[model samples]
Every structure is written in C-alpha cells, then in structure tokens.
Target: MELRLGISTCPNDTFIFMPIIHNFVDTSPFTFRVVLDDVEKLNGFAVKGILDVVKVSYGVVPKVKNKYNILKSGGALGYNCGPVVVSSGIFTVDELKGGKIAIPGENTTAFMIFKYFFGEDFDFIPMRFDKIITAVEEGKADAGILIHEGRFVYSNHGLNLLADLGELWEKKQSAPIPLGAILLTDKLKKEAKLLNNIIKSSIKFSRNNFEIVKPFVYRYTQQLDDDVIKKHIELFVNEYSLDVTPV
Candidate 1:
C-alpha cells in the first residue's frame, strides 16, 4: 500500500521538511508519493481525498475539519510572530477595504491572514509573492501581502511593510500565528505514530545534512544564495511533534 503527502516549497517549510522528508522515507514503514504544490492546490488535494497526508494552512483547518485532521506536532504557529503584511506605501488593513491585495493562495496562511485582518469582505488577488510585489509596485492594487521570499525582497520592489501578521496575533493572543501544518485524512490516526516518527527522523537527518539540501532549497527558491538559504533553514523546521495539538 502507499500514501500521498502534499506540501509547499516555501523556505520555512522547505528547510524544515528537507531533513524530514529525507528521513521519513528512509525510516518509515509506509511507502508514499510526494506532491509539491502551492498551499491552495495542496489543500484541495487532501480535502478532496486526492492525497492521504498533506500540509495545510492553520486557517483552512476549521473550514475542512470534517475531512482532515491536524498532525499537531509540526504546526507553524504564530508563537507571537508570523509573516508581516506589506504594501507599496503606508496603509492600514482598514484602508484596503474593497481594495486589491495580492496573496499566495486560498490555503496559504498569508491569504488567511489577509482575510482574518481584513474580514473576508475585502478583495484579494492570488499570486506568487514576487508577482505580488510587482503588482503592488505598478499600482495594480492598494497594497500587497507577501510570503516566502517576498518578506526579504519587499524593499527591492519599493514597497514598505505595514504590519507583521504573526506579531499582531502574538500581541493579541500571546501565541504564534498557528500557520500551516501537516495534516492527515479524517480517519488516518493509524498514521499518528508513523507520521510523527518520520517527521522527527527527517528533522534529525536534515540537521546533519543541511549542506546537501541547501542547493535544493536555493534551486526551488529562485536561486537564492547560500547565506540566505542557510538562514532560511534556520528559520523554520522547528521541533517536530508526532501528536495533534489542542485548539
């Protein structure tokens, strides 16, 4: 038998998963296929039962709860911080009401963030962060919400940051944004132990083999240099949990 795993290639996740994926496959009992897609498509895959295990945004969890289960251990919570909100100029979330905001995808924490802060009533145009910067710069939208490399390159596009969505959540609730997380199918609890072990082992292997995976991260991330790649690895892939966390 086989299982399917879905995920995003963002640096935060990429760094964390690099080691985990390598270790998971090597040490786990179940063999599986891996699907790397943007957060939006990835969420759909698992939600539709097209894939067995996948990564999903924290926000999307409530919407698809009946169909999926949160893996708990590796969730990307705000922990008093998350991706910041940025734009071409000074603006508040309220200012963007009815305006255009560039975002990653419906299943992305960034998109949920935009929705959470803006109250699902605003207009958001989904696109890659890099493209979001260009769209905002060209005055296509009132502002933009960035994720991935966009965090590092916002200034390059002549845009200024307006907020840190994660930080904002921390300030409000004293916890992380509870961003993206690994998920299991609704009845896949049988995977709890295996999934947990695989993630733990993957992280262990990556810590020792970062040099080998650095190129993979860079290649997928628009050829980011070693320094940035190393930093990327450092930022995400925190302690892996093999259990579900409480709400």
Candidate 2:
C-alpha cells in the first residue's frame, strides 16, 4: 500500500526519514510518497486530514486527535529543545507585553507554549517559521518565536532571546518539551504499530549509516553548514525519536 507521508524540511525530520526515503530499510507492502514542507503547513494538512501520515506540532494534537492516532516513534520531544523568543533589541519579559510578536503558526507547539509562557496579552503575527528571525531583524516585529534551526542561529542575526519556552515548560511542568509528533490517520489505525516500527527502524538505520544520510540532509538544508546540520539532528533526534517516553 502506498501512503502519503508529510514532514518538515528540518534536519531532524530529514535525518530520521533519510533511510526510508532512500529505501535503506525493510518497508514491505508499504511505500511512502513524502510531502516535505514546513511544520505549520504540515499542521494545516493534519487539521484537514488529507495525509495518511504526518509530522505535526504537538500543539495540534487536540485538533487532529479525532482524525489521527499519534505514533510513539519518529517524534521530536526532549529537554532544552523548545522554541525561543528573540528580538533585535533587548526587551525585558514584562516589556514584551502588548508588543507585536511574529510566530511560526497559530497552531504550532511554539505558539501554544508561548501563550502559556507570556500570557495572552500580546499581538501575535503568524508567519512561516523561517521568516520570523528576518522579520524581527527588519523591525517588522518586536520579537519572534524561533523554532527548528532558528533556535540555534537567531543570535547570528543579532537577535536577543527573550525567553526559552522549553526551559520555562520544564521548570513549570517538570517534564520534557514535546515539539512534534508523527500521526497516522484513523483509516490506518490497525497499522499504527507496523508504521511505528518502520519509523523506528528508519531512525536506527540513519544513526548506523549517518555517512549515507548526511548528504541527504545537507541537500535539503544547503544554507546550514555541516556543524549546524549535525547539531540540529543531535539536539532534536534523541532517545525520544525512537519513542515518546521521556528518558
């Protein structure tokens, strides 16, 4: 059976799925036609229930729970791996109140935690995650929430971090931050275990054969250097990538 699989272009997603994309694993009776896009777009797709499988912000779970069953493997959840709020100018957390902020998406986990962290008093401008840092730098926004590689590179753009949402969540909730998760539509509910295993195997294959996977990752994110790409994968794809249970 063929499945429509949706994922982001982020390094962790690319790294985990490289083996599956390159046919380096045993995926009998199943072939994935992957749709690579931003996490917000994937979240929109999940809300619409268009894909057989997808990676989406964990914040979208409440919206798509009726449509999909979340799988344990192939997810991004860990400590110190959450979105960061950044700005070109220094602003105290209180000063950011009522200021205009650029966000990845209204439905993203980042936005959810952002609201929980800063309260619901700020004006949120929803945009593509990749454009947030630039928007902040250009004075289009008072601050922006940075996810994926943005969490690492925002300082390079002369942005100051106002808050690390992950740290806030950990301190307040005392748990790892859940950034994203893999979901399988209810039509394939019976196959959730099989699909989860396939995803876990793909992650394991990529780890053991990283040389073969690195070029694929670099190809998709050519703007990021080797170290950034590696760091992105190392930070996001951890013990949780194989299963959602916190270690």
Candidate 3:
C-alpha cells in the first residue's frame, strides 16, 4: 500500500527522511507519497486526519490521539534542544506575564512549553516559526518563542534570549524534552513495527551517506548557512530520533 506521509522541511527532518523518500532504503511493505511542510502545518493536517503518517508536535498527540498512534521512531527529543523565548530587549520571566508574545503555533510543542512556563496570562500571536524572530525584532511582539533553526540563529536577528525552555524543563522534570514525533494512524497500526524499522534504516543510511543527503537538506532549508544546517541535523537527529525512549 502507498501511504500518505507528511513531514517538516527542517534540516533534521529532511536529513533523516531523505533516504526513505528517495528510495535509498527498502520500503518493502509500503511506499510513500510525501508532503513536506512546516511542522505546525503538519500538525494541522493531523487534526484534519488527512495523512496516514506524519511528524507532529508531541503536544498535538492528545488532540489527535483517536486518529493517530505515536510511532517509536523518527522524533526530535533531547537535552538542551527545546524552544527558546527571545525578545528585542531584556525582559524577565515575571515581566513577560501579560505581555504580547509570538509563538510558532498553538498546537506546537514550543507553544505548550511556553504555556507550561508562563500559564495562560500572555497575549499570544501564532505565526510561522521562521517569522517569530523577525516579529520580535521588529517589535511586532514583545517576545517570541522559537523552535528549530530559529533557536540557532536568533542572535543574528538581534534578539535577546529570555529563557531556554528546554533547560527549564530539564531542571524541573529531569527528563528529555519531547519536541516533534512520528505519528501513524490506526489504519497503519499493523505495519507499525515494519514502518519503524524502515525509518530507523533510513536515518542510518543518511548518517552513513551524509554527502548524499546534504543537497536535499540544503534545498529545503531555504539556503541557510551550511554550518547552521549541519548543526541542526547534529542537534536533532540523535538516538531519541531513532527510537522513542521514556521522556
């Protein structure tokens, strides 16, 4: 069967999925029709039950639990790798209360973390993840919660770090932060193990053949700096991505 697959265009996602999408791995039991979009868009697709398999924020799991099952492979989870809150000027966490903040999406893990840290007291404007830094820099919002490559390059946009949500979570929960996850709908449940292995194989293939997947990563990254792209892949595609361990 050919499954409808959805994933983000981020470097870590592109790097791990390049081999599978390009037929470098043996996708024996199933073939994929892929759709690449921003991670938040993928979450919205999940809510609509539009894809057979997708990468979505873990925060979206509860809302779409009936439509999808969390896959054990192909996720972004780790230490010091969570979302960051940034602003054009210095602001304390206490001062951020009731202030305007730009978040990637209401359904994103980043947004969930922000809520966990600050509660429902802030004015949140949901925008594209790539736009949050600029939104803060331009004073459109008092601050922005950044995910993916935004965390890496926020300083270049002249943004100041307000808090590292990942570090905060780690300190409080003493667990790895769960960012994005691979979710397979119930229709694909029987093939879950097989699909998981295929995803694992794909990530392994990409790591061993980095040069082969580099161009694909670059293509979706909007021509980001080569070093930044490499750093993104290194930071996100780790053991947690290969298998979902307890968080």
Candidate 4:
C-alpha cells in the first residue's frame, strides 16, 4: 500500500525533509505518495492520523509525544533555528505584551516559540504562513510570528523584524535551536525499518545530486535563486536527518 507523506514549503528547517522524502518516493517509486500543506494544517492532519510520516518542529515533539514518535536525524541540531517576529507597530517581543499575535497554528513550533518568549497571557490568532504576513501588514494583528520562507520574504512586505528566535535560543541555551524533526507516527510503528532506510537513502541522494537538482529547487521556490536555497539545503540535510529518538 502507498503511504501518505506530508510536506510543508518552509525553508531552512525543511530543506532536508524534501530531499529525504524525494529519495523515499524515488527509491520505492510505487509504495509512497505525498500530501502537501502549510505546516499549520499539516500538524492537525498529523494529529488526526492523516499521515504516516511528516516533518514537525522539535518543540512540537512534546505536544504529540503520545500520538507520534520523533524521528531522529543528524546535523539537525546545533543549527541556527528560529522564526522572526514581525508587525507594523510592535517593534520587539516586549511590545507584544497583552496584544494579539498571529501564529501559524497551535501545534506549530512558530506558535510555541512566540509563547515561550511572550508568555501564555498573550493572545495568538492562528493563520497559515501565507496569510500571517498579510494579516500583520494590514493591521489584522498587533504583530505576527513567521517561519520557513517567511524568513526570506518578510522584508519585501514592509514588515519590520522584531526579534530572531534562533538568536535568542543560542544566547540562552548556548546551542542552536532544536528547530525540527522528521516524524513517524505510532500508526506506522511496524514499518520503522523500511521507512528509515528510505529516508536515509534519500538524504544520501540529495547530497550527492544537489547540483543536478539545483534548478528544480529554485523552480519550486520563490526568486531566492539556487545559491540561497542550496545553502539552506546543506544546512538542513544529511547526518542530521533521522527516523526516531527516545523521549
């Protein structure tokens, strides 16, 4: 049977997952299929048992621990990971006090990151990444927290970057934010070995063949060019990618 795999188009954190996922489908060809969505909806999908495997934030592991397993990946940690806070009026995390902050979704790492620094008292309006920037720009929110491609595109919207969560994590913990992880749900627990092999092989393929696919990555993404996306790919892929870790 073909399994359902979910994808999000976020950059930085998700670069590795793309290649690893491609490898699985390319290698098995007939046994796997993918479902795509913004991370917001994807998290709910993951919770509802809609996907066999999905890319999820490290911060999200704790919330879904009983329902899913956090797959381990190499080179994923110690990498600079964080979302940028943006708004027309709120200039800093400090300015967000008691105001509504637009979050990607409740289960998203972006939402947790905002909550971590802003406290639970702050109100968060859930929106997808595609809509979050606009909501903040149009004054639909006091401010917004953005992740993935938003990191590269927020400035174009005339929104100001209030704070860098990755930078904050590093200063506080003296390590890069444990940004994301590839997840395999308990529903697929019996297929762990098969799944792990496919992911590993795909990661290997992407690293070895990145030059050939540079155009493809660029084509699918915005106008960032191959170099920038390539940098993110290198940062996110490889030894850091994984299939599972102990809680």
Candidate 5:
C-alpha cells in the first residue's frame, strides 16, 4: 500500500527520514508518497485526516488522536529542545504583554507552550515558521516564538531570547519536551509495529551514512548556516527518535 507521508522541511525531520527518501531501507509493501511543508501545515494535514502518516506538533495530538495513533519512531523529543521567545531588542516576558507576537501556528507546540508561560495577553499573528524572525526584526511583531532552525539562528539575526519554553517546561514538568511526533492513521493500527521498524531502520541507516544524508539535509536547509544545520540534527535526532522511551 502507498502511504501519504507529510513532514516538515526542517533539517532534523529530513535527516531522520533521509534513508526512506532515498529508498535505502526496505519499506517492503509500503511505499510512501511524501509531501514536504512547514510543521503547521503538516499538522493541518493530520487534523483533516488526509494523510496516512504525518508529522505533527505534540500540542496538536489531542485534536487528532481520534483519527491517528502516535508512532514510536521518527519523533522529536529531547531535553533543551523547545520553542523560544525572541525579539529584536531585549525585553522581559512581562514587558511584551499585550504586544503582537508572531507564531508558527495556533496549533503548534511552540504556540501552546508560549501560551502556557505567557498567557493570552499578546495579540497573536500566525504565519509560516520561516517568516517569524523577519516579521519580528522588521517591527511587524513585538516578539515571536522560534522553533525548528529558527531556535539556532535567531542570534545571528540579532534576535534576543526572552525565554526558552522547553527549559521552563522541563523545570515544571521534570521531563523532556515532546516537540514533534509521527502519527499513523487509526486504520493502520494493526500495522504500527511493522511501519515503526521500517522507520527505525531508516533512522539507523541515515545515522551510519551521514555523508550520504548530508546532501539531502542540505537540499532542504540550504539557506541555513552549515553549523546551524549540524546543530539542528545533533540536537533533535537522538535515541528517543529511534523509540521514544516514556519519560
């Protein structure tokens, strides 16, 4: 069966699925029709139940759980890996109250965490994740929550960190932040283990063959600095990706 797979174009997502993209692993009876977009768009695909498999923010899972089941492999969950609030100039979280804040999407984990810490005081402007930093820098937004590659490159753009929501969540919850997750539609529940092993195999293959995967990661992240791309993969892709050990 051909499964429709939706994923973000972020380096980490691309890194984990590199082998599958290149058909380096044995997908067996399952072939994937991949669709790449921003995480928020992928979340929308999950909400609509349009894709057979999709990558979505953990924050959006509650809304989609009825139609999808979380896959153990190919998820983004780790320590110190959370959304951050950034501004063009230094400002405390309290100082930015009632100001315009750019967010990747209302359904994103970044926005959910942002709302948890900052509350509903700010006027939220939802846009594609890539546009947020530029929006804040141009004074279109008072601040923004940075996720994906933005978390790593915000400093180079002269953005100041207001808070690392991941760190805060870890402090309060005492567990790693659950960022993104892979979900298989409920119809595939019986095949979850089989599909998961294929994903794990693909992840393992990518890690062992970084040189081969590097070009694929770069294809989607060409605009990012080399160092940023490296850190992006290093930080987000870990043992948890192979199988998210419950915290």
Candidate 6:
C-alpha cells in the first residue's frame, strides 16, 4: 500500500522520520510518499482528509476526529515545551488584551492555548511559525506566539516573552502539554497498530544511529546551528514520540 505521510519541517519531525524516509528502517507492508510543510499546513490537510497520515496540532484532533484517529506514536507532548507569547517590549500577559497578536495558525495548539488564556478579545493574525518573531519585531503585531525553533531564538530577535502558555496548561492539568499528534485516517484504522510499530522503530533507529541521521537533520535545518538543532530535537522528541499512551 502507498500512504501519503505529512509532517512539519521542524527538527524533531526531521530527526524522528530520517530512518523511515531514508529506508534505513524496515517499512514493510506500506510505502510512503512524504509531504513536508509547516505543522499548520499538515493540520489543514488532516482537516480536508487529504492525507492518509499527518502530524497535526492536538487542537485539531477533535475537529478532525471523525476522519482521523490519533496514533500512539510520533507525537510531541511534554512539559515546558509549549508556545511562548513574545513582544518587542516588556508587557504582562494581562496587558496583551485587545492587542494585535500573530499566531502560527488558527488550528494550532499554540493559538488554542492563547485563546484559552486570553480569550478572543485580541486581534489574531495568523502567519507561518517562523515569520511570527519578525512580525512582532517589525510592529506588524503587538505580540506573537512562538513555537518550535522560535522558542529557542525569540530572544535573539529582541522579543520579550510575556507568557508561557505551556506552563499554564501544566499548572492546570495533570497531563503534559500536548503540542502535536500523529493522526491516521479511519480508512487506515485497521493498520494503525502496524503503522504505530513502524513509527516507533523509526524513532528508535534514528536515535541509535544519530550520526547517520544528523546529516538529514542539518539539511532541513541549515539555518539553525548544530546546537540549536540538537536542542530542538531533544526538547520535542521525547518518550511521547515513541508512545503517547503513557504520557
């Protein structure tokens, strides 16, 4: 069977998927045609039920639940790994009310968290995740929610963090903050267990053979230094990526 697999270009995704994409791990029973884009785009694909498998924001799962079932492996869920709200100048979380803010996407968990914390009173301008820091730095928006590598580099752009949405969720909930999830459509439900095992093996293979996967990681994240890229992978691809059930 040929499966359409969609994932973000973020370091964690690139790292965990390297072995599978490179055929280093056995991906028998299915051949995958991959689509790489930002997480929000993948979420959109899931919403449209265009892809057989995709990495999507956890916020989108409920909306796409009828079509997609959350997979047990290859997801991002952890503490202190949530989106941050940043601005060019110092501001409190409460002060952000009624201000224009840039978010990664409307369907992103980051945006959902922001709304949960601050409500819909503010103007939310949705843009690519990487563009959010620049949008705030340029005054295009009063503040922006930073995710993925943005969390690592926002301060370098002179952005001030007003709130850590993930921390808030952690305080309120017992479960770790679920940023993204791997979703497989109901049409493929019967094969979900097999696909989950394949994903788990891929992640284990990549970690055990880090040097072999390092080149692929660097290739997708050439703009980020080796240290940032490594940290990005470490922060996002935790035990949850291998199995989300326990998390």
Model 2: ten consecutive residues of lowest lDDT: 218-227
Q: How many backbone clashes does candidate 5 have?
A: 0
Task: Estimate candidate 4's alpha-carbon lDDT, on a 0 to 1 scale.
Answer: 0.66
Candidate 6 Cα outliers beyond 4 Å, as residue runs: none
Model 3 alpha-carbon miss at residue 3, Å: 0.5
Model 1 lDDT tens row, 1-247: 4778777777656655676455434645666677777777776676677777788877677777887777756555535336667776666766667877777777777777656665776677887655777788888877877765566667766777788777776677665466678888877777776777777666666567777766656656843656655554455545423333544
Selected candidate, larger lDDT, 1 vs 2: 2
Write candidate 5's Cα lDDT for 1-247 as tens digits.
8999998999988988878977999998999999999999999889999999899999999999899999999999999889899997757998888889999999999899888877998899999998999999999999999898888888888999999999999999998899999999999899999988999998888889999988888888735578888788888998889899665
Model 3 lDDT-worst window of ten: 222-231
Kindly report which residue stretches of model 2 are placed more than 4 angstroms away from their true locations once superposed. Answer: none
lDDT of 3 at 178: 91
- Quote the lDDT for 231 in model 3: 79
Ranked by TM-score, the better of candidates 1 and 5 is 5
Which candidate should be chosen as best, given TM-score against the real structure? 5
lDDT of each residue in 184-230, candidate 3, tens digit only: 99877988999999999999999999999989998888537988888
What's the TM-score of every candidate structure? 0.86, 0.97, 0.97, 0.81, 0.97, 0.97
lDDT tens per residue, model 4, 59-156: 66777777787655432554554687888856777777788888877887767766676677778788877788889878889888887667666788
Report, for every candidate in turn, its global Cα lDDT versus the true structure. 0.67, 0.89, 0.90, 0.66, 0.90, 0.89
Candidate 6 — worst ten consecutive residues by lDDT sum?
Answer: 218-227
Give the count of colliding residue pairs in each prediction.
13, 0, 0, 11, 0, 0
True lDDT of residue 36, candidate 5: 90
Evaluate model 2: give its TM-score: 0.97
The residue-level lDDT of candidate 6 at 232 comes to: 84
